[model samples]
Target: MNYYDGSFGGMHLIWWILWFFFIAWIFFIPADIPYQKSKKESPLDILKKRFAQGEISKEEFNEAKTIINSAT
Candidate 1:
């Protein structure tokens, strides 16, 4: 076997395989650009929504809001 044409010091095509993954990482964007804005519901806002939906009465909503605000 010729030494110059051998499998890169007996390693079978390692450089090509490494380059393939390196180039792929540059284009992968699941955690990068075009970020998604997350909507965080505040305690008071959530209480108001529940009251509007009839999940809780006005007195209950006011009680919960006062408790939440006093705690903070």
Candidate 2:
């Protein structure tokens, strides 16, 4: 019968692999659905859209734009 030494080299490798997977899971997995912003719309673009949709008048849009510019 052969006596085995209690070396932990294999266990160390497994622990390292598990740690890597844990970190990868944290980065890649989202806890909720992700939100995406429209690529085409700036603040001005959205204001124009609201005007076009008759949600606001051109005068109101200009007034809002002035307020937004002042706030920035």
Best by lDDT: 2
| Model 2, C-alpha of 2: deviation from truth (Å) | 25
Which stretches in model 1 have alpha-carbon errors above 4 Å?
1-33
Q: What's the lDDT for candidate 2?
A: 0.84
Deviating ranges (above 4 Å) for candidate 2: 1-40
Cα lDDT tens digits, model 1, 1-72, are: 656754365345777788888889767846734667767999888889999999998889889988999999
Pairs that clash in candidate 2: none
Tell me how many residue pairs clash in candidate 2.
0
- What overall lDDT goes with each candidate model? 0.81, 0.84
lDDT of 2 by residue, 1-72 (tens): 755576767878899999999999999987766685446767877887898999998889999899878887
List TM-scores for all candidates, in order: 0.52, 0.40
> In candidate 1, which residue pairs clash?
none
